[model samples]
Each structure stands twice: as C-alpha cells, then as structure tokens.
Target: MIAAPVTPAIATLNTGSSSLKFRIFARDSLDLLMSGKVTGIGTDCRMNAKVTGTGAQIAQELPGADQEAALAAVIACIDAHDDDWRIDAFAHRIVHGGATFTAPVIVTPEVMAELQTLCPLAPLHQPYNLAGIAASGRLAPDAQDIACFDTAFHAGHSEVVHSFALPQAMRDAGVRRYGFHGISYEWIARMLAEQRPDLAAGRVVAAHLGNGASLCALRGGRSLDTTMGMSALDGLPMGSRSGALDAGAVTYMMRRFGLDADALDHMLYEDSGLKGLSGLTNDVATLVASDDPRAAFALDCFTYRVAQYVGAMAVAMGGIDAVVFTGGIGENAPGLRGAVLDRIGFLGPVESLVIPANEERMMAIHARELLETRLELMP
Candidate 1:
C-alpha cells in the first residue's frame, strides 16, 4: 500500500455541459497531484486521468454515463492509488451564484436550494455543477464542500455596470449584467498583479476565449465591466453558443419560423457559434487546420468579435493599458490572438501576454480562504 503525503489535499471539480474536469492538489503548497477529464458524458463517454508527477494513468470507456457516475469514477481512480490520501476539502466551480453570493461559501442544504433557484440563469452549467457537489457529498460524506462561484469575482461591479436599460422592476428582479468567466478573470488578475504589477494596476482587458468565451475589464485587480452580460451566451461567439443574438431575431424565429422555445434554446446554446458558422467542428485547432472557406469565415468572425469587445472593454475602463489572453483558445491560438490584436493595435502600445487558465487553482484558493475563515471563527 502506498503511503499518503503529510499534507492534506483538495479535490477541485469543474463540470461543464458534457464534461467533468478534476484536479487534486496538496493543500499547503497547492501543488497538483492528479488531473483528469471525463468527456462525452451523455453519449459514448470516456474518461482519461493521470497522476500529475508520475506517468501513471487511467483510461476507460464510461458507457451511458452522467456527471454523477463520472465523478464517482474519478474518486475511485484517486483512491485506488493512495487510499490514505485525505481530501480535506472539496472545491467546486459553480457557474452561477446570482445576486446573493459574492464570494466562496461553505455548502449547506439551504445554500444548495438557493443555488437551484438560479439554475434557470445558467441552465447549461449550474445544474451539473450542483450535481458534482451532491456527488462529492455522497462520495466523501465527511469532507467540507465549498462553492467558488464564477460570478463572485464580478460582484463588485458598480450599479451602472450591472444595470440594464429596462424598467426598475426588471432590474430589481435580477435582470442585470452578471458577467461570466469571472473565475478565469480572477485568476488572470491575481497572476497579472503578481507578475506584471504595472499592467495590473492600470486598466487591463483580459480575454478568456474558450468554448464559452468572454472579455473582462480589470483595474487594480477589480472588474470594471465585462463583455458578457446577464448570461454566458451574451458575449463573443463561442464554440457552440450563439453569443449576443438580437432579441428581435429570437422573436422572429418563434413567429416566422415556427420554432418553439426548446428548439430556439437548442439552436442558441448547442448548434450555433463557430460550429454553426463553419458548418463543421467547433475545435479551434481543427478549424485552424482546415482548408474550408467556411472555417476561415468562422475564425474571422471570432477574431473580429473579440477585437470589437476589446474596444468596449477599453471604454469600460476609460482606456486600455494591457491585454491578456487566457483560455483554451486564448493561450493556444496565437493566430487568433494576433488577429484580434492587429485590429485593436490602435489601443496600444498595449502590452499583450498569454496566460493559461487556472480557474481550478482559483477555486482552490477561494476554498482555502473560506476554510481559514471558518477555522478562525471556531471557538
């Protein structure tokens, strides 16, 4: 039997619509011990996991699976290696905290219920996020579960930034800008503040260009405003989401095209964006490699939208000081980044840098903070 390390560990779970990503980290130093992802959850599912330091890996098919089953598999895989390893805290990346939660909080039955109410705001992500939490509770009944909201980092935005040009009743009913990609933005702010203090102190536009893409304007480690408003689907074109479609178009689809609400939802959330534009795969690498003119058009649209949002982000912060890209596409696709920057170069001599997404680490950090706060309050 392998002996567990002296330090406690944190299991961070990040669940998307069709995937569950997990990482275990040493609590004291925050070093990664293991990382894995389970993909195709609702279909021909598969899981691929590996021990971080060692080359040991686990790969298998997960037939007819869901997030709960996939999460259980992850726990089993971790325990198989080191049965004694203590997962002291379970941190989750919850996509929506709505207007109530401003920071990470210890999960309770009441809190979970409150979270369920906000699921309609983030239908694609919130329910799965809660499922991961519930699965963790069942798997490790004694562990402390913490929810680090993706919207928490943007909670400090001024009322003007969050306001919609609607009636006061609508604004009061939580119909206002609540930016997404905030966990990624929070991580970027912390990284920039540590690595490039000057840029971090000034106005900076950080673009998190992933499958679900958004841009944020940060100044002195705070979000001024962001491209995404009220929902995740209101920003730059994403891998599948139709970002920022006009309200009239949606109504036209319903009345003129006879599309029902469910069909429209599926079209906006599942069949749009780059995939719809290119009529091909949503994978950026594949799109970049393709000879298809449609692929080129999709890429061009993505870049142009990003550049346009950067201008808006700059306006939100009064001016641009630096531009940071960090996401699956932002960190890896230099061509996309260059295309965006070329159009927005007039906003420079703006510094440009690519930082990898670390929302998992950011969640772990929030979890640790909430834990410390609880400990300090203990008698």
Candidate 2:
C-alpha cells in the first residue's frame, strides 16, 4: 500500500491582539477545508476547529499561550486531523502598509524589514502580524508567506483625502490618513458588486463596527475616503480604543499626569473607548443588556459617532446611495444599527444593508491569485 499524496491548500490567518482566526482552503476550488480560532491569548487560551464537510473537529485549551504558541497549536490541530491538506501559502492580514505596499506581495526578507518599520503605525496589530509570519516561517519553512494589507484597499485616496493639516515635512514623513480595515471593506465592496450592482456603482458608506471600527466611503467599489486616519485609534470608538480624540486633550494629559509614550499608548489603545465610557465590559451585547446609565451613555455615544461618520462618508462621496453594515457588531446588533440608521433618516430613505464580513476568504482569494500569477510567469 502506498500513501496518498497530500493536497495543497492556502492558509489564511487573521491575527488580532488576543485572537488568531484561521481557515484552510483547497487550493484548486478555494473551498473551505478547516476553520478555527485561538481565543484568549496570554490567558486561558482555547482552540476550536472544525473540518469542513465532515464531522472531524478539535476543541482544546492551551494554557498561557501567546501568538506563537497559539499558531503552533493550530498547526498541530491541522496535522492531527490527517486532513491530507498541506498549507502551501500562508496569507497574513497585515494591519498597516504605510505609504507604500498598496497590494499583496510575497513576503521576502526585504519586505519583512520594511514592514517592521511600520510597527509603530499599528502597535497593537502590526507586531503580532509580523510575529505570526516569523512563526510560520519556522514552523513551515517550505510554505510561501503572502502579506495582504488592511490599508491597501484605501490606498487610492486622493491627496485631499489623505492629507492632514500639518507641516510639509511631517506630511511627507507619512503623517497622513491611511485608513484601516480595508480587508473587511474590500470584502464588502466585492459582495456589493456581486449582489447589488446598482449600489456598487454609486456612493456607499460602509461601517465596520467591531472591537476596532471605521467607516469607508465607497464610490464604484473603490475607497474614496474613510473615517480612520493614520492609525486604528481614529474613526469610531471601539471596544477598547479611543476614536477621534482631540490632540489638545492628549497634550493636556501628558502635561497634567506626566504620561509617557507607553502610558499614553496603553490608555488610548487599551483603556479608552467603550470600556472607559461605560465603566463596564467592552462587549456590546453586555452593554446593551446593562441597566447602568454609563452603559447607556456609551452605547449612545457609539451610535451617535457612527451616524455622524456616515454623514461624513456621504459628504466625502458627494452623496449616499446605500449604507452597508459589516464586522461583528455591525452585522449582529440590530438595535444599534437601527439607532444609527434612524439618526441618518434625514438622508431620505437611503438603502440599508447588512453584509457579513469574510476577510479570510478575501485573503484566500488574493493568495490564490498571486499563486496563479507566479505559476504563469514561471518558465
């Protein structure tokens, strides 16, 4: 008896601050083979995976696992299932590409170095993203690593949309708006083009409301403008991120409290936003269920800001044809969505849609396309 040959697959990794969501897709058909996530990293971590089209599943706890450990467990789960699928490419969700790298590219040493320089732009996300890439190289050196940037979809913004009112030197040094969540927005754009061609060609506002939220103005499925600026900490207030804070307040805090860079980073990135506003959990469902006035206020603020930004996005595109809601909170929270849409009712019966985000699939699509292009160019 001879062993069967392993099937090649594309592994898509969306590494977040405390979670790593992944999916394995068949290289030829792009069908999902396995999907899972490692949640609660650095604490009581858990890994759950299900082999698509079958009953094969994995559910286990990884004690005190970090990103690398979590990814190792994911690979172990893949190997344990004997699924006969080998990951030929690792498609990573890179949070920031800065002013360059506007498209997916095969990661090389030079590319990795350039990406490292961008870690400061997305401190909470970029480092972990690159860490996953490094771990994948060690764990599976034969696999090709491809970087799919979250800022790439918005890279075509005009100079007016990308600039900040700053000195020429600072502006030239990359101190300008470079929107995040392009992966989710790109998926939404593609979905709109496929499902609602009428709206796809017109002005659209997409709200990606989750732990990290932002609004993108899409004209003809291309990003015309967005709410996020320079960092994920801008735009709409998120689970634990302060959005659209006044620069004066930051300076005031620094002077009054003697807060250093690290202190400010932690407060703004991890302690502000919904968590700070509510003085309760950052989870929207929990906040919605709470009777606390602070929770109510937090929810109110979130919806109000979302509504305000929708208007801004509409203004950016000159008008609005449709409003798209995506991301975790955007797709699930109806009351919140209603609150936002209700506030924007003055826009006169704007079309409203709730599209489920599938960024993993988008990354897989990019990987497959890049692979095909590489194969075609081979002699």
Q: Which candidate is the best by lDDT?
A: 2
lDDT of 2: 0.93
Candidate 1 lDDT over 1-379, as tens digits, reads: 9664566889999987689999998887898889999999989889999887777888989997888888888888888864356888999999899999999899999999999999999887899999999989998998899999889999999998999899999998889999988889999999988998998899999999989999999988899899888888898999999898888999988999899988888899889999999999789999999999999999999999999999999898899988899989999999999999899988768888999999999888887888788889999
- Alpha-carbon runs more than 4 Å astray in model 1: 1-5
Error of 2 at 320 (Å): 0.4
lDDT string, candidate 2, 284-337, tens digits: 999999999999999999999999999999899899988999988999999999
TM-score of 2: 0.97
Counting only residues 3 or more apart in sequence or on different chains, how many pairs clash (N, Cα, C under 3 Å) in candidate 2? Answer: 0
lDDT of each: 0.90, 0.93
User: What are the clash counts of all predictions, listed in order?
Assistant: 0, 0
